[model samples]
Every structure is written in structure tokens, then in C-alpha cells.
Target: MSEGVTLDRTGGLITLGAADTLWADLMADSAVPTASAALTSFPAHARMGYVLLGDRVVATVKTGSSQWSVLEIEVRQAAAELNAVEMDRQDLVRIGPFRSAAKQEPMEGTALRWRQRITRALQERGGLERAAREDARPYHLAGIDWRRILVEQTRDRTVRTWWLPRAAVRVLDAAEHTETQWLHAARACQASAVVTEPSSHHQQVPALGSRPTTSPDCPTAPLRPYNGELQGHLYSVLSRKPGTSRRVAGWACAVCRTTPATVLDHCHEHGYVRAPVCQSCNTQERPDHLYSNDIRVADHYRRLFDTHAADWLRHWHRCPGCRARTTLPLPHLAAWTAHIACRSLRPTHRDARSSRARKPCGVLRVSWTGSHSAPRSCLLTVAVDFCPSGEHRVLAQVPYREAAEQFRSWLAETAPAVAAAAGPDRLDDLPTRPRPVIADTSSDGLALF
Candidate 1:
């Protein structure tokens, strides 16, 4: 071994103690360099400066700011110059005639001594070196276990030892020319890692023959149809088998045509899928009662098959219900009626009951509008608003007969005085003046014409 710290010769590698913070700052800088313009040289006065020796990088930073500069240099040449002189252990580094002392304990190992020596050499070259002697307390180089030291191989075929950092640490080397390039590469890699897309294991759309018990748009809870036949029809229409022909590739709702068909609406009575419909049409058709009978479902299917016979034959070999091309029976219709009649018996068919149970009690508002200002416009709008809780919302609208009935029933049960103030005779024609009735009523009443 040489008089100084032995350098590993197998690969051009070296070891030195570094402050965890300085090494962290370098790696961080490697990840993200400030947007500030580069400076030509170290400023006249620096708040704090540190010397490290792995790749030979010297960092000078402003006291309270993130602004910093890292410098790399020839380790062999600097270490040689540092060994030329002999001094007491108190000496940290020598800058020409000026010398700085370790305030606590003198550095023992050759690596640390070389670092101190090189730091002073650079300061001397710049003519802004540390004063005659360091009066500050010596920083006990943090103990880094050799076993845990991270060895990183650079592209230049040179391996370097990175001191393990508990937190922000010191640096151990200098190589100024490559500092900017290294930082840029590190940052690019970090950015790429950050923006990489994450993979999810959950499937949104199911394969053919497999039914999804949940809708993608609303994922709060899963949807489980009451009957197996209903579930099968839902799966066939709502999902597609891989590689199947897509007649309605960009198909929109048949009823609204304005919105995408996300919900698979079916006849509640026959459990037969009618067609894809928007949420609005689904709500509207639920009250139609036109498809409430088995005969009606069969008639509707016959009409659909007759109109799109070519499309039906292209996808399926025969009618799904009867499994025969000649005559189609209403097997789904029977399943639908059976499911509806015994729905309350199933444990999973509790969504409707649960929803109704959660309905809150609040206020009511009614509004009526005549024709608008547009030419040849004949629009009469009637809407009813109800808020059982503080959240005011529109309960119903149009013809206003159903809304009026609901309002009257709620009024009679909760706040009868408000209903009496505005008599039933004027229900069609809301009173011009606002009625003052129950002051502490749970619901607020508003009537506008």
C-alpha cells in the first residue's frame, strides 16, 4: 500500500468519506437542475463551499438559496500536490501560505486529507481560497459502512463508490465537464419514470358470454339482474365478444341519439332487451307501460326482427329465445314477469328499496312558464321542485298533474297550512302573491308563474 490511501487498481476506483447531504444534493441535482443560467466561475463570495472526492466534484452554494456549482478535477494530480507537505493533524487543507484547521479532530485517513488538499488547491487557483487557517470545528466525517456503499459504473468504464446517505450528504469527487450532462440524463430518466402509465388489473368491459355485474361509467356498486335470463340478455347486448362484427361501432342511443348508449334498457315485464337508450329515455320508458305484457314484448321483437332481419341473421344463427328461425317464443318475457313478481324475495334485489329508504324530506318549489319570445314559439313549461334535505332539487316537470299530486300529498302530511294558504282551486294558476303559512316548516315553498 502507498503512504497515502491505496487506490483500487483492478478498475480505476477510489473510496472516500462524504457528507450524506452533499451526495444527495448532487444526485438531486442530477435529477433536477435549476432553470437558472450557468455561471462562468465561482462568485467572489460564497455562503458555504464543500469539497468531496469520489468523482472529484467541488460544490459551492449560496447560504440560504438552492444555487450551487459543482466542479470536477484531476484526482491524482491534486492528491500528489497535497502529499508534498507534512503538517500537524489539526491542518485541514493548505492554500499556498494559508491553512485551515479542523476545529474538532484532525482527519486521519489519506482520502480525506487528499480532499482537503485539493479543495485548497482549487481555491488558491481561483484566488478566493479559504483564509489562512480554518478556525471552525472539524466535521467528523460520517461513518459509512463499506458493505452498504453503492458502487456505480460510469459509461467511461470507470467504477465509482457512492457513499450511502442517511439523509442529505456530502460529495466525494470532482468532474465538472460531465456534471451538467449527468444531471440532465438523471432528470430525463426521473421524468420518464414519473410519467409512465400505470397498469390496472380490473376489466371495464367483459368478454362475450360473460356478463359484467357493474357499469363502467358508474362504479360505486355492481349491478346484478334478478333473473339469469335477464342477465344473459344484458351480457349479450352490453358486451361484445372479441373479434365480433360491429354494426354499431359508433352507435349512439336509439332513443336520444344525442348521448352515447351506456345503459342497456330492457322491458321490465318481458325481460327482453329492447335497445340501447340514454339515461333520460330509460327513465321515460320505465313509465310507458306499453311493454308491460308478454304479447307486447313478442310483438316488439317481431317488429324488430322483421325490420332488421339481415342484421339479425348476420350475427346470430337463429332467434335467441326460441332457438328456431321459423317461430320465436317469448321465453325472456316469462323470465321478466317471473323476476318482477318475485324480485322482493331475492336478497340482491334490494337496490330499489334501499334507494327509496334513503330519500330525504325537504322543501318544494313549483314554476310555470308560458311561450318564449322566439317567433312562432309555443312552449309551455311546468316544473316542480322538492328538497327534503338542504339540497334543493327539481322533483318533476311537465303536465304538472303528477307533480301537483305529490306536492299536495306531501303538504297534507307535513305542512298543511302552506297548502291551505294556496288553495287547491289555484293549483293550476299559482297565486300572484307569496303565501305566508307555516314559519317553522321543514320545507321551503316557492310558486312562480
Candidate 2:
């Protein structure tokens, strides 16, 4: 046995000649010493690369911590002819092509933005130069021709105002033609057009001698039969083979993951649908919709509270109400408050009595007093009051009231049994201590306590 080597259960330096010979050899050598000795001397900071040729094995092991180790391993592996080409041709083709293709394709967001910016910049510069070079000789012409020239200039300006961007014009013309064709097809499929009769039709009957005939003056009755088969055609087109352009284009609803729906929902606020959405999301997002209003209001209040609470806690030295140092910044406070509050308020569907019994076991309120205090100390007060028994009340001065309230509510709602067992009165009776102050050289005293 080597002096530094320590044998393990596998016996001293027993190596295998299987598919992973290099890995086996390394394992054997490493295991020969105790973990601590191996770590201190040879170390476990080694990597091995191995290739298998049917039953034949070839491998190279290198210590990641030493350059000499890698060089030796590379030389040994090269001598053993381990770097033979044995990967499947299909796998090589697929992976090789994919890697090369990825390099050639443009990155989605940034590439598109860059192209658009370049195009806009070119258009602006070219348009300005062209406009500046346009002749204004008409304005300098004889008085007799001035009026005509002025009219022509005015007409040109009007035409320019009505001009559409080339891209937009192309799209609009295409859409117009499509709409016209669709309307024509629909009409052709209908048996007859429904027309409304005039109120005076009874009195305006043609002269008695006039032959009974269909004429432009005579109104047709309502409820005409459709003569077109457009609907059937549309259904057929939509039902085509799965990867067809029509089917793909028809798959517009991102939420429900359906196709050929009533209406497409575009979440204007979110800009794009990361996935499919249906008309439900659209209806809920309508401007006049109550759901939309509620969502917007909730988001606004959440953001407002988050921002102000953060600023208040960061700048304030003491808790707003109880004047305690346990008050943390908005984020920490919010998390704690949410945890507590959710535990206290547990809404259930069993009955009104049970639900009310669960209704917020605690309440927290934060009011800012407009005072120009040094380093500003916002008074944070926490009050934990329960309803059912109406026997519990606890108040503490916390730095971030909003966070404290949130945590309190969360805890109340999520863990009712634990919360109720703790009893609200216990909070007030608990020992109170001053929080450590954070040292500040700029101030006469510590800013936080």
C-alpha cells in the first residue's frame, strides 16, 4: 500500500474496465484515501470524460484544481484513442443544424425594435430632404398666376393630409376587397333580399288596370331566404388539416385555447397575449365593466400602499403608533402582516354565522400625521382586536403598520385554530423591549431603534 493511500470497503485501487473505465479508475483512486485526506491532498475537484465503444471502455480523468492534472489526463486519453467518432449520424445532424440555425435567426424583441427604429429614421431624413428641395416658384409667379398657384398648393396639402402610409394603404385595400367579396358571397347565398313596405302601400295600390307585376315601386315582404353557402365554406376552411395556414390563423383565442370564436380578446393593457385568450377575458376587460373597475382599483391601491409604506418605514425611526422598534420596512412588514392577517380571517361557505365568526379576527389601521420631524418618525400603531368573543384586544407600536396589519390578517385567516388559541389579550401582556438602533455617523444619535 502507498504511504498516503487509505483503503476503503472496495479494496485498494480496484479499477473496472467497463464502459466508464476512466470514472471507475478515478473513483477507485479517490476512495483509497479517507474523505478528509483525499480532500486535503488529491482532492475531489476532478472531472472525467468517457466514451464507450460497445463493450470497450475509454476515459480521461482530470483534477479541476490543478493544471498539471488536466494535461496528464489529456495526454493519457489521447494515447488511448478515446476521442473516436461514435455519435449517431442523425443526432449529430439534428443538433449541429439546430445550433447553426439558432445563430442565424434574429432575436425576437430587440431585433424587431432595431429594424423599426432604423426604418423610421431613414424615412424621416428622406422625407425632410425631399420636402426642402420642392420648388415654390408658384408663390413668386405673376399676380395673375398667384391665385391659381395658391389653390394648387392648398390642394396638394389637402391631398398629403389624406395620404396613407404605404404599408397602411396596402393593408386597407386588401381588407376592403376581402370585405366586399365576403358580402357578395353572403348575398349570393341568400334566396332573396328582405325589403320593408311603405306605410301608404295599401292606399297607393297601382291603378286597377295595371298588370300585377314585380316592380321597383312595389315593396317585398320581410323574411327572405338566404341564397349563399358562405357559412358552410367558412366551416370547411376552419376544419382543414391541423397545420394549415387557415387553421393556424383562426386560432386567435389565447385564454380558452379555442379557434373560430365569437370575438378576439386583445388585452390592451398587457399589450400581447403570451398565450391564447377567449372572449371572456375581453368582456371582463371592457372599459365600462365592473370587473375591470374592481381590478384597476385593487391594483392601484396595492401599488399606492406598497410605495408609501416602503418610504415611510425606511425614513421613520420609530413605529408610528406604539413607538416600538419592531417595526420593519414595508416589504418585511407586508410579508409579516399578510401572514398574520390571513390566519385570522377565514371565510367559509357553511353559513352566515360561521362566516361572520371567521370575518377578520383582527383590524389594523395606519394614519400619517403631517409633521416635519427630523429623519421623520412616522407613528405606526398596531391594534389586534377580535369580534366573536369580543374579549381580546392587543395594541403594539410597530414601524410599518400596513405590513403588520397584512401579516396579522393573513395569519388570522390561514390559521384560525392557532390564532384563537393564542388569544388576542396575550399580545399586550408580553414583555416589551427596545429595538437596537442602527448607528449613523451623520446624526447626533442612532436613526433607528
Candidate 3:
């Protein structure tokens, strides 16, 4: 009981162990006394980290409020014990035996811009003096070993802080070589999730008793043959012994977890297959230096709305005030009128670069294509007196004039001002048929006039 242990929480019970010593942390928050004083007096926090075996670290997160369900008890070796070499140049004072692996000359137009960015970076780190002195050093054929360096790389505002050991990584090069130490060290940090056990857990957890850097043997299935442009290079780097198609496909797309992986997405700057991605995610374009796969995330939302428009429309109810089918719930006349007016007030645009869609008449109104008869049309059509954006439902055709009268009376009673302005004239002015135009037809059964 004196030694600390790693812990995993399932529902109300906490499973505390690493090397097999079980303990528990329960949830009772009334200041009651218990046998284990430590558990009773545990501080209220979302996450807890503990040290075990002097150099190993374990962590858990609270997943529930009432029961304090701590989850994903993971153990990691302390970075210090690896005799990790610090590679940051901020502390260095001399040019001794350190240089970039490859020559990178800025193009004609970018020379000044590149120099300015470099200067700003150097100034921030207080390394301008060291850099100036290093420029005087004679060119040498020797290159620094990237394996021993500890560097911080930044992409998409998320700073990746890690140590790169050469033997544990592999990256391909322009010359079709998979032994480039610099490229491997640069991109190996993004490897796809390799460990899957304990069905509920979705993260990559290292196998118990295995070194943190060592990945388990690839699956037994035969490797898939490559037929792409980089056949030789891809096979050499990706088809290595510990790599397998089953293993890659077993992992979800790194950008969007909902899709199974089909493409090995890598950093083009350095040939490292960071993770497996879906076709949509791998092909999407993004701005330079922003590598967080925001394009894939955007596409996810786009497809969600585009594919499930009908499903979403089901949740909306007709507004009594404007009879528009909006995201707002029904019977709330004031709110519905306000929502329509606000949407219609927004400026419209045709520019592809605009973030917001141009809604010429912010209202979302639907039309009745069931009948051309006045009474029947008024009862069934929602987009007739308003913009076409409001049509979001399928209605059964009705010949009853009472239904039309009831809707008109409800609209006038709910919003007197709007009804007074768009009164009988609007209803009487309803178009019998939509104009013969390209925008008249949509798969959703809603058309814009």
C-alpha cells in the first residue's frame, strides 16, 4: 500500500494497478470518514498524475461527476531517464559541429521575406548573435546526427514537444532513400495509433512491459501491393516489416475519426507517414504552415448538413407568425417572425470567398406545387407569400378552404404588424406556377422564385 500505482476507472469503481497492485477511488462527497484516509481526502480535480518506480508516470481523468469515473490509466517512462539530448540552440554559444542537414535557398521573390521571418524568430530567441557568428564558418561536408537532438516543431498553433531518437524512426527522401535521418526525425512523431486493446479504449496505448518507442509486430495479413508513382519509395518506407495494411486500415482517419483510413497521409516537407487518412481528407487543400487538417473538419460539417437536410427539417415546426420552416421551434410567433426578419436582413453575395451565404430574403419559405386552385394552393403552400427558402416539409393536399382561412387568421393574430403589411394582397398575389427557370428545380422539393 505504500507504493503508488496506476489507475483506471470504470463507472463507479477505480482499478488502480501497474505491475498488478489493485486499489480503488470511490465517490462520496459529504465529508464522511473512511478507512483509506488518502482516498477520502483526495483533492477534487479533473485529472490526476502519479509517479511510480521513481521514473515512470501514470495519469487518469475524471469522466463522471457523481461517481468520479477515472479513466485511461496510462504509464509512460520519464523523458529524463532516456538521457535525452537537448537540441535547442538557444543555450548554445558556439558554432561547434552543428548545421542544417540540407541547403535551403529561398527563391528570388521570397528571399527578403524569408530573411525577415528568420530574423524575427532569431530575435525572439536571443540567438541572433550566435547565428551571425555561425555564418562565418566554412562549409563542411559533415552533418549533425539528428537522433540526438531535442527540438520543438510548431504547426497549426499546436507545438509538438518531443525527443526524436534516430533508430526508432524511418522517413523517405527525394532520392528514393528511406534512411534519411533528418526527415525521419522531423515527421515520425505523427505515426498512427498502433495499439488497440480493451475494446472501450480508443487511443493508442503502449503494450504493457514494452518500451514506449517500440511498436508491436504488424498484423499477419499479407501486405498490399503499391501501384502509385512512388512505388519503390513508398514500399521501401511503408512496407517495412513492422508496417501492415491491416494495421493501417485498423486505424481511423487521423483528420476525421468517423471514416476508415485508406490513404497514408504524410508531411510532404519530410517523408514521414504520420497517420492513415480517408480519400476526402488526404485530397483536401489547406493553407501553407497550417497542418492540422482543418479542411477535413470543414468537409465533415458540410457533408453532415448537405446529406441530412431532410432529417434536420423534421425537427423544425411551422411558425404561426410567418408560416416559415426555420430551425426555431413552433408556436412561438414572436420568435419566428424575428428569426425570419433577421435572416432576411442579412446581406446576400455571389462571391465564393464569402463566409456567409447571401440570403436575398432571409426567410426560409416553401411553396405548394400540389394544386393551382386558389383555396387549395393557399392551404398547402408555405413559400407562396414568402421567399422560397421557407419550404421544408411535405404536406398532404387538402381542398378544404377552412384550413386556408385558419392559417391566415393564425398568422394575423400572431403577428398583427406583419399581417397588416403583407395581408390579403400577398395571398391574392400568389403565383399560380413557378417561372420556367434553372433555379425552379431542387431535389429537396423546394424551389426559389
Q: Give the per-residue lDDT of model 2 (tens digit) for 1-449.
A: 22322322321221222212333233333211111112112111123122121111122232233211212232233223222312221111000111123234343421111112322332444432343366332211000111111111122353210111222212222222222233333355344545575443121222322221122133222212222212112223333446543222234333323222223222121111122222232222222111211111112223223433332222221122121223333322332333233334322233456655533443333222222121124343333334344422333444444455454454345444433433334335322432222221111110000
Ranking by lDDT: 3, 1, 2
The regions of model 3 sitting more than 4 angstroms off are: 1-3, 6-449
How many clashes (backbone atoms < 3 Å, residues ≥3 apart in a chain or on different chains) does model 2 have? 55
Q: How much lDDT does candidate 3 score?
A: 0.28
Off by over 4 Å in 2: 1-13, 16-41, 45-331, 334-399, 421-424, 427-429, 437-449
- Model 1, stretches more than 4 Å misplaced? 1-251, 288-449
Alpha-carbon shift of residue 314 in model 1 (angstroms)? 17
Candidate 1 local lDDT, 100-170, one digit each (tens): 22332453432333234433433444322222243222222211111122222222454211212211112
lDDT of 3 at 382: 25
- Local accuracy of candidate 3 as per-residue lDDT tens digits, 232-297: 133236756464654555454454453445556442322223455444344331111111110111
Per-model C-alpha RMSD:
32.9, 38.9, 28.1
Model 2 per-residue lDDT at 98: 15
What would the TM-score be for candidate 2 when compared with the true structure? 0.17
